[model samples]
Target: MSEKKNQKEKLWGGRFKGEAASILERIGESISFDRKLYKEDLEGSRAHAKMLHKIGILSREELQKILNGLNTIESEIDSGEFVFRSELEDIHMHVEARLTELEGEVGKKLHTGRSRNDQVAQDVRLYIRNRILEVLDRLDSLRESLYLQAERNIDTIIPGYTHLQVAQPVRASHFLLAYFWMFTRDRDFFQFAASTNDELVLGSGAMAGVNYSNDREFLASELGVPRISPNSMDAVSGRDHLLQFLFAGTQCMIHASRLCEDLILYSSQEFGLVRLPDGLTTGSSIMPQKKNPDIAELIRGKAARTIGNLNHMAVLLKGLPLTYNRDLQEDKLALFDCVETLLISLEGLEEMIRELEFRPSRGERSLKEGFATATDLADFLVGEKGVPFRTAHELVGRLVSECGEKGETLFTISEQARSAISPFFTGKEYDRAVSLELSADKKNSFGGTAKARQIEQLKIASESLKTSSRTKE
Candidate 1:
């Protein structure tokens, strides 16, 4: 008799005189995608039922029966034996309807002191939290793969670029490690996003606190959330956590897109700085001899989609009056698509990086063509001749200009540099500036492209990957 309190013969139909139109039924349904939240919904229900029983709203026997019904419903849905009707509107409705069918009126009491507003918020938070853990694990694996890639190229030489022009000669390991750090920052962002979602938000019923004396901490611990939300009104309408995750995803994609763009250029016939593995490339439809960087190109464009999705989600959250609006329903699609895009993009980019081969000879030669060591030449004058840097820079520029006019290289015109050395200089010092290998070696400042510093960086990067993350469990 208690289970039937205020219970309508047709559930929510007690408030309406007639059934909804067929078009309204179709327009209002979310079972197509929100059904993915069934597991989250079921888990939250179990926690709620246990809490309700402890607080004496649900008797022990009633709790067991309700839980059993929920378990049966989960099995049916997981096994694809349960049918979702559009008229049911969402996962919460379909799940509650099935629970009532299986356990009689006692199932109807399962929703006591709760509303779909708070329930959906809790379900989506759990979903994002769990997915963040998955992405973190994948990032760890990708970090390991990057460490291996850097190790293989520890002694390899490459031209480091600035503004798409070769700027300096560097150990290829250093180049790879730059990306390793980029991903490390992305990993940090994901950890922060996960922390933001770790707070449970389930007891806030319909923009206000639930009527019963609900133990939110107990519910949060049962649900594996580390904390409970502080405000009921904010809890019911919160989408900021989802926004933060999408922002992190967009940033990760931007990092990957930068690498993809580089590989696309490097794998082209003109650059030939690196070669893409055949498995990751596609051939041109008409040009039989052409192997195209289609994967890189696609991943690059997908980055834009992730960015657009973030922008779109921000627009949806903006101007909302607050406390669970219908517009919030549109968020799941953008968040889901953005998360999926980053996961695939990250994994694919890691594989491409792992398999690609660098052409050391071409990269080494490019260092010369772009005057990558021009600054090094100036530094040499400052160090050896005590020449003020500005004067040395001008003197080197004039000397380089003369060499360019005669179609000569710095390597072939060491005498010009010797003649132009400051009053404190010797003729033999200019010889060191001409060698690209030595030019790179002489840049021994910390974080420089010097081989020794890069080797030291490789060790730091390796240790970074090995250390356990500080992320909240």
Candidate 2:
């Protein structure tokens, strides 16, 4: 009895006669992950078949048979009954082989003028477009979480930090809005990435123009692709769009990771500025007193992994030639892994943020140790006493230095000493200048630290998120 030659041997036997080595097959196969692209693949194929029929390349009867077979294949795959063979090299070949088994000769016509190069590119574009929307929705959910937290804590006071040292009193709403702006910028980048790959590369063939005068525009419109790629060679070979996607994804993860780091630090017993619900925290096996911020820690850790994946892809593509190469196969794992990591991280962050609780007084207490109100005192000297800003800043620096030497807060300094150190000072001036309450209230600029402005910003952030969510739906 003779063993059957696998689909790969049959598909490319015109150039090579031997079967692929078992190790080669394992290393080269992408069915496990590329199967995720099956829906996008089928969608592209349907549009291509219709265009082929319209152009008289494939008969209407053949197109019907191919489309029917594709639909059946989609159902089988969706129902988990589809047999994905690794010997097929990748999901594209597995799909093509399955279609051939189902429709005989008509299945072969699916590849008439199309190359696997363009086919893969098209599938990726379709997948990225949908994934961008997925990312947008997740980010919007996060923004909503932030907005709600901001609204609830509009008047709650926390100490804002610079270099991990208390800088000034700030409303909790202002802090949440900081993250809101981060995500808003991330959403903009996601939108830009989606548009970057809007062009259809399906009819470009393998690094060269197609021989047949097929209606590429008709196929493009059918697939909802925004435009046609300008250069056929570049279209088939370029993974810059994927690179853009990775960049956007990495930056978003970085933002999320930074937030996670802050949350973890804030929730620590030492800081005690925030609390993780028992449902969201984990306990150590050996330490009864520990309710660790595991979710935030994992998010922070995964951000590193996501960024490393993006860097791996960038290095992979750096020295490659203009046309397609087998080296490009590494892109699938890099891209798919980044997408999965980002989605998980985004959703997990949204969950954690929704349940987050802040200890406003705990955050406020941080200011007591660090002279957080020193800047405010300087500004007060400049405004109330007509002291030049430079003079006031120097005087405040001297005051802070003196306070450190005497082991006292700015408010504890003697009025005689303050007046002696700076001409701007007077009786009871230290009491008025170092008050956190006054500092917070005096910040009345638009988007300032004042509670009123912070609440206004929260309302705007909440409405913006609501508008985005409605538009997406």
Candidate 3:
């Protein structure tokens, strides 16, 4: 070969007669970010090499040498000894080049029935599969923390809100478990994402089935994946699994943001319904008395980035033509960011929840002051006194209006003033109607805020964590 041909072969194989421009090399390189896939890439290569050997494309000696070379490369990357080059373009090329350097021509045989397209697709699927388990584990940790908090505060009452105004009284445990269940659904979403990524895409070649009769079943078994891609073109081109992973992260972050919002609001002096642990909070730079929930706030802020990441993946795949395109290179930017953001957020939120302190007195005081027992009064009149619900609602509305005008609460209203509202509004019944503890306990229906229901929920939540642990096993 001529020197130019040799140089071209060095860069990419002998497919080109002219040199690639520096700008094209720079712009085309994904080594900086896609290097995150080195482990996955190396694993896929090892599996493909074994498959090639099974099909008689490689001698046993060649297969052993390639596996040894791959193991060494993995160690180099793990120990930060690997040097990634832009000229190599991506993790797939980097691993191949290093293997070729270590094993000579035998390393070149590793790609016998594989293409960068299918290789990259397989790497991403493996990456997503591993990450989904991690996300689920973190989610389980957060849920466990919530369960413990709920167990500790099963009888502690707090004002529940609709439109951000106190609407009713509920046990503090019920409030915490609301988030527990949201995270539970987030866990389900991640598991579904994992299932979607469980297929092996190797042996699909570039965009069609390879010429060799490679044993994809053996490849799948070696890689620990359960299924093989049914269509070669779809195997190389599909990114639905990646999109699902991003969507799952986006949903988990949204739930984290909501939990943060509640903690931020409740930890404020005006609400004072809860206090975040001092270790989880930060001191203000200028103010001596400020303990800021900076971690929660940051987690809340990062939720937007996850949302943007999901949107990025969705839009990136929307207009691409099938079988593989350079546009797919951008997919990892969102995928990796969402994974990091979500894991960190889950860890931070779990730490915060584990140490959270609920101020039951403050919560009860707020519930009393906000007329959170109004619905309980309405229910008492309808159930005990046989009063029509609309009449009871109107009567309670008037009583609340009067209390507001006179700066008197239901507990402070006089017998005469109470009876004047209605014949059913005697002081004794009014007293029973407005007891915050009784108000919360009276909601004894299934999934209600009563203490018994909370106990039942805590049992269910514990079982859920155990079930998840078994599933993981």
Candidate 4:
């Protein structure tokens, strides 16, 4: 039967005596996932065919037939008419098989000097290169969402926390800008990954140099890459570019998960710092009052998978003494998974952030009980009263404890009780020292949460976003 012959007719089966068992064939098959690389495979093949024709490997008539054949195959795959066969193995083999079916001998000549090893290397680099640019766009969109949100809430003050306890008051814009900087770094990493993919690996056939007079640099230009791999062995064996993308994806996911964690906490009724939009939240089936931050919670949980994928690839390559090994085939699994996971998380978080509604009043009013301005009081004592910092710290600590015991704010403390520690203490000075607005304004050093500094940061970030967008950075 044709099905029976298909198993023994594999491209690499010339030396084998028998067909692989069905289970082994199923185990080795990558068509299920690597089919996603069809576009890159087709692109590389066309470039290879053109290079062959330029060097007189194929006649003018044969090159035209090859081009038409490849175009038809690409259309078939794009229009959902292409049939993927497990027997053909990966995206590359499938494309070649279809090309041969279309153009006979010329299609067969397409693989004249290239090996699947180098072919797949090129395909992965191309795919990752495209994905790197795509992820940067998403990151920029998310940054824009945060930027607009920060602009809208520029003067809105809310408690800032350290160790889960309120430490000081800051503009809501200042808080949002923190995430802008985090993802800016992530964008830089993706750009680095893009630069790493600039080398061509297509001419490094089967882990050694090919015999053809192929123009690797010309092929690089056709593929929009800047250079060719220097050594064939390293070109075929190296996967550091894929690793760079995976590592960048993992770090981005980590940052996104941390942002989601903050969203989860802020949306909770206990904190009530932000309100989740009804469309982005879920309600409990049993509890009438339950509204959950399900999207953010899911993002938080998905981070473990990305972190695991990064580790999986790192460990997969740790022991392989490879010029090229069969084990490398599984690298696509991690790369594809990490890329998709990060994209989904980025898109979802951007939507949630765009719809987020902050409840600044609730957070602002809680600053007194938590003594968020205590440090300001200490600073005033140190500068105005010349009290030793440690002495001022101890004095503030005792007063804070006493206020808590009496179920009162520092402003409510008796003047006699406050002055007992220092002769310079007075009601006016105490009120000014404990003022939350003055406390935040006092943070005027660079990168601080002072309102003026936040405005300056916002202007710089907005301009950076505009420049990067125009330049496609």
Candidate 5:
């Protein structure tokens, strides 16, 4: 009788007469990580219990008891007094087990119209939905930081690079806004991910519809979800929502990684275009004069982890059979890690951007050294001298080569060399063409690097931030 009671306490152990192997318990337990879903799990139970009472499967008294019990458990967990046991296998079981202890057999009825399969699915959707909002908020903050810096530096010029080589002069605002746009797209991706997870899947019991006439729409409403899953089998089995979220996180992190790369490179002594805040950097143990951009470097490295997590989730879902399987337990490891990584990275990157200081003089020096205005000179030939673009390009290329061979820059190139390249190239025309400030300002086309266009872009970005904030509210 005692053995039977123990087996019964296992929840799904009714079919078995033998005890589970200890090793099986060790390998099968998910309460360690899935405990992060405690709030979602408890909330799901409260909704499920209320739905059970609505369908007359549970008494009003039982519903009240279950709700009270769940509330107490939530407090216990919140106060760090809850015990997480591997023997319970997962959060669902732990929650149910605790509820049963508190409310007697009525606690068992909490699982009446649903299974852990759909329960976990619902919890993950809730988790993803909440995390998407957080990511969007962080992205918004970072975008604002970028916008503010751009506004402050509208007149600041920097060398824009292609293939890691300086290609042209651009407003610092333009350079910063480039990242602002990348994160804007990342915010859109996260919003899509949130939409994908909006559907409530709580009514999907295991892999099939339950016998009870439960009101899933009510459950959806209680859970603050906008829609209910249409098909039971797909609802419990599908992991597409999680995949979309992971993909969004991966893309956001990739954008952050790119930003970090620029920060790292620009902060280096070799480039010296920007300086990281001391609070965001670290000192090397062996070097007395080293203030390393470790924060940015770590964010970049963690992006690889987010990418790997996305791949991990994709491969985990690839060969699985329809419906929930034990392998699904592995999903939270990647999901939780990616969420944590992305949130911290976003915060770190935002702080870094907020504190970053740009050296305009260094940027101007790099532009001169790299012949960053060569294209502008070429354009001058085409636009001013009526030289065909191909001829202008060739002429500029020759001038650049001659400057390089003579150990001079465009700013230092002699009048003799300018005449050798093109008879139209006088010292005044060449100087005007190569002026970094003039080159940047001349790009006055829509979305160009000119101060006028950057001001327009900043206004647009500020409006976008306002819209996003309104939507968030």
Candidate 6:
């Protein structure tokens, strides 16, 4: 029997008879970062201890003492009174140190059929599972905010853009619902990440099946894991669940960055289409009349770092042949960093959007400069003048260019000038071409730019938010 002073004297201390180099220890240590996993590690240890007792590996009285001692330590940690020692190496040893302090000989029995490798795999999964749920809740809140805004703006017309140039008219609600759908896909990605965390990795015994006749199913159930990992080696070594979550985080950040870009561009003096509230904007240091959209810009820039984190994880896992390796420790910092970045970005964006005020008159003026209603003219020519769509399209193009040459709008062009471009042109055709009402109303197809379709989409988005909130609860 070997009894050691601490973790440095126990498992994994090969090759060093003296203390480790300060730099080496700091690089190898995960406690400062992984202390966040203390709760999950304790939950896993409690489940393993209960299973050990059920299999007659420990006496009933010993099980009671271990369980009771574990509960006390949990309370102390939550109250912030527990002291952590870097000498313990990690949470597993730190918790075991406390258990041994309370239960003496019985605390030694808790390690009968486990290894730190599988234990750490369990802890990371539990942490990611919980964090993904938290992100999903935030996403649902943002979805609801957009849904409410859509409901209010359904009738407001705005210029649709292609290559940052006004292309046509769109309901403001329709543009908002685009984000609603983006968030819906984000929710689905989170659901996939959570589902991948459904298995138990305990009882895997480092890298092989343990010799003990352990009840893995019982251990899995006690840990709230849906099923035991089928292969002990894979269970101890695998990190696909973390990768799945990183990928999902990348998707979310990408969507947020795009939205941030649009908001920043729209709020610029050149666009003059939107005004970000004071809370979300900042003033230039030397300029007296500058209100910069700094928050939106930061959100957009941080997304690149988040995406880089995901790529780092992928490249790290790509070539490793494993049971367990020190390389896996990098997963914690990467994941924690990415999730924290995402949450802050989401919070700032939600606030920015809530305070967003669109300038409809400015938007309408921009829409007019593009001869944006020409598509409506083309459609009318096809329907009423019995002209082929291609001909109507060509004729509309000619009318648009002629208006440009005359330095006038489509409405301001003379009747003779319009007729010179196309015999299909008439008073009714000219009126329909500039009618914003007809442009928006004629687009009533499901999922179109029409106000009615946008309203229906808003109702659907609202229902989605309510259902997702209840699911998270």
Against the reference, the lDDT scores of all candidates come to: 0.82, 0.86, 0.89, 0.87, 0.90, 0.84
TM-score of 2: 0.91
Alpha-carbon RMSD of each model = 4.6, 3.1, 2.6, 2.1, 2.5, 3.4
Error of 1 at 374 (Å): 2.3
Estimated TM-score for each candidate: 0.90, 0.91, 0.95, 0.95, 0.95, 0.92
Q: How do the residues 256-363 of candidate 2 rate in per-residue lDDT, one tens digit apiece?
A: 999999899889887898888899889999989999988889989998888888899999989998898888888878889888999999999999889989997787
Q: Is candidate 4 or candidate 5 better by lDDT?
A: 5
Clashes by residue pair, model 4: none
Query: Model 1, 191: alpha-carbon shift in Å?
Result: 1.3
- For model 3, state the Cα shift of residue 363 in Å: 0.3
Q: What lDDT tens digits, residue by residue, belong to model 4 across residues 1-473?
A: 22233344887777777667766677788999999898898899889888998888989999899889999998999999999998787888888889889889778899988999999999999999888888998999999999999999877778898998888988888889999999999998888988887789998999878898888877998898888899999998898988888889989999999999999998887788899899999999999899999999888888999999989899989998869999999999999998898888999999999999999777766787788888888889899989999999988888888888888887677888778866555778888988777777788888887878888999999997998798783
Ranking by lDDT: 5, 3, 4, 2, 6, 1
lDDT of 5 at 196: 88
Look at candidate 3 and give me any clashing residue pairs: none
Candidate 5's C-alpha runs over 4 A off are 1-8, 388-391, 416-423
lDDT of residue 168 for candidate 6: 87
Candidate 6 at residue 337, lDDT?
A: 90
Better of 2 and 6 by TM-score: 6
Tens-digit lDDT string for candidate 5 (159-242)? 899999988899989999999999999999889988988999998888888888989989989999998889988998888989
Leading candidate by lDDT: 5
lDDT of 3 by residue, 252-315 (tens): 8999999999999999999999998889999977999999999999999999999999999989
Model 4 RMSD in Å is 2.1
Give the range of the ten consecutive residues with the poorest summed lDDT in model 6.
1-10
Clashing pairs in 5: none
